[model samples]
Target: MSLTIAVTGMNARADNPGPGLAVARCLKESALAPRVIGFGYEALDPALYHRGFVDRGYLLPYPSHGEDALLARLTELHEREHFDVLIPCLDAEMQSFARLAPTLTGMGIRTFIPNSHQLALRSKDRLPELAAATGISSPRTQAVYQANFFHTCEAQGWRYPLMVKGLFYDAKLAYNADEAVAIFHRIAGEWGVPILAQSWILGEEINLAGVGDGLGGLAGAVMMKKRALTDKGKGWAGISIHDDELLFAAKRFCEVTKWRGGLELEMLRDEQGNLHLIEINPRFPAWIYLSAGVGCNLPDLLVRLALGEQLLPTPPTPAGVLFIRYAEEAIVSLADFENITVLGETLRFGALA
Candidate 1:
């Protein structure tokens, strides 16, 4: 029998799309051909209407609604879909999902995600401590509870052009106190306090996506260098690369954290050739389909691991593989829109070719 898998973060906005749709694409194209259920918070999330990518679509309560509302919704969906595995692709929802893992397991829904402690350790506010513990070099970062810190930060020896960041998402380069304060309020208003302020490092950014085997070993790893970026600084075009230092950093990270499930490591390589761990995203990045392009297929591996199957050693990822992401429109029938908006669910009969 084909496994039923549920995935979240279906929003596909051109600026900063979520990782779920790409993950769904990976799973659909995998040999298992598992049934894909796309879960989103809004009715207009484009991936829900994508014909071949999502076999079924459902709306979920916003993460702000708290875990009880989330669990109730998942339970209802489970009664209808009997999902064998779940992949949550958003950072904001990781806490709730990780906290509910045992309850989800009791309900027969398996998730391969880091536990609460692991998730907390790698969070934005805790990156400094985690880096220090693992012997990784990360820029000096601190949590700012008030926007006023931006204006007075220079007095404390923090120079201009700092990196202002939200806890779950959004990052901006603040060139001066005004820019820093503006960005701080904007991100804080949306994602809430305390916003993060980090020393800006001039460097080339590289990223790695992989699954940890929950035992100090990375199951599979794929690295990429962004060729082009969207206005929001998201990767718009990227090329896969094999860098030993980057790979070693990832291995050391896995060894130290014993992270499970999907993870994205953001790194900045300075002009001096030192790699600084910038951020640790608890879930897959939006460029995750590149994993399939390089033969790792991390989402598929995640599912297999969730199902308690042993993963074969991943082959070496070849350098030079490229992925260029583009925006496209999908025709959504009024009937489907009505189902999602009114009844909160819709099913698609289309099958992948």
Candidate 2:
């Protein structure tokens, strides 16, 4: 029998898309060809209406609603969907999902995600410590609880053009104290504090996406460098690459944390050619489809891992594989919209393929 899989992070805004739709596309194209259920917080999340990608769609309560609300909703959905596996692709929702992993397993929903402690170890505030533990270099970073810190940060040896970041998402380059304060308030208002400030390094950004086997080994890895970026600094186009240092850093990360499930490593390669670990995202990124394109197919591996199947060592991804993201309209019937807006679920009548 084909497995039913549920995935979250379905928002696909052009400026900052979520990873759910890309993950769904990967799963649909995989050999298992499982049924894909797309979960989003808003009715208008474009992925919800994409008939080609999501076999079914539903709306979920915002992560801010707390875990009890999440658990209750998942229980209700489980009775109807009978999801065999779940992949949560948003950073904000990861904590709730991680804490609820055992409960989800009890309900016959398998999730391959880091536990609460593992998640905490790679948090933005703790990146410096994690970098040091892995013998990798990271930018000098500090947590900011108030905006006033930006005004006097120069005294603490922080310079201009520093990076201002939220705990879970959003990063802005603050060129001066005023800009830093404004960014601090903006991110704090949206994602809440403590906001992060890091010494800026002039360099090109490189990223790695991989799955850890939960036993200090990496199951698969793919790396990329942004060729173009959205106004929000999200990668709009990228090319896959193979870098030994970057791969070594990822291996060290998995060895130290024994992280399970999907992870993205953001790194800055400085003019001196040294790699600085920037941020560790707890879930797959919006560009995860590139993994499938490069022949690794990490989401598929994650499903196999969740199902307790052994994974073979992934083949090396060929360099220069490119992914260019584009936005297109999904024509949706009013009935489908009403089903999600009014009843919170829409089941497409079709084969799994």
Candidate 3:
């Protein structure tokens, strides 16, 4: 029997794409040809309808619905599909899966992911502390509970053109106090309390994606510099680069945190050529499929690790390989939508080809 695997984060909208589609694409191209199941929260997640990449698809309850609801749904799906491993590709859902990792293992569903503590340490608000512990530079930031804090922030040396960020997602640049307060409330309403106020740093963005062996070592590493961005500030086009400084920083971060599973490091490079850690995503980035093009194939390595197979260190990816994101329409009949909306699952014929 083929190895059965389920992957989440299937929303592939142009403005805000998720990492699940790229991960499934990597697994589908593997030599083993594992059976791929696309798990999504919404009925219209593009990956669910993309038959060329996803062999089967299912809809999962939102993470906000609580773990019991999610676990119950997964149990029902597992009885039919018998998935052997699950890879969560979104940051917001990582906490839920981390908490349920033991239960999943009991049900014979293996996952390679960081513990809850490791996830907490890498949150946006705690990133400054992590950087300090690792001797990496980070932008100065403050946590705010109320919008009124913006009135007095000027006295604390926080100037105009600051960044207001939510606890879970979304970041907006605020050029003035009025803008700061407005953006804070907008983010807080969606993602919740203790909004972040960060000093804006001017620099180029660099990203590193890698996997950890659950021990103190790293399994594979790939680095990229974003060449183009979407209107929502997501990297739409990027080029793989083999920079020693980037590799060293990624290795050092894994050493300090001992992070397990896939991780993406967002960094900033100033005019003087100093690198500052900006954010640490506990899971893979939307651009992770680029690893396969450059010769690393991180998602495949993650599957081996989850299955308890020993692996050698992955070689560095070749530099200058480019990945450009584009939008494509999938031809799914009305019956396909009904299957997922009403029954919550669907398996496409001839999907594995």
RMSDs, each prediction?
Answer: 1.7, 1.8, 1.7
Q: Please, what are the lDDT tens digits per residue for candidate 1 over residues 231-326?
A: 999999999999999999888989999999899999999999999999999999999999999988999999999999987889889999999999
lDDT of each: 0.93, 0.93, 0.89
* Candidate 2 regions with alpha-carbon error over 4 angstroms: 350-353
TM for every model, in the order presented, reads 0.98, 0.98, 0.97
Of 2 and 3, the candidate ahead on lDDT is 2
> On residues 1-353, what C-alpha lDDT tens digit does candidate 3 reach at each position?
89999999999888789999999999999875899889998888989878777888999999989999999999999998899999999988999999999999999999999999989888888878998888888998778999998888999898989989887778889999999999989988888888999888888989999998888688998999999988889989999987788778888888888889999988889889999888888999999999989989999999999999989877667899999999988777777777888988764673232
lDDT of 2: 0.93
Question: For model 3, what is the error of residue 266's alpha carbon versus the real structure, in angstroms, after optimal superposition?
Answer: 0.2
Clashing pairs in 2: none
What is the C-alpha local distance difference test score of candidate 1?
0.93
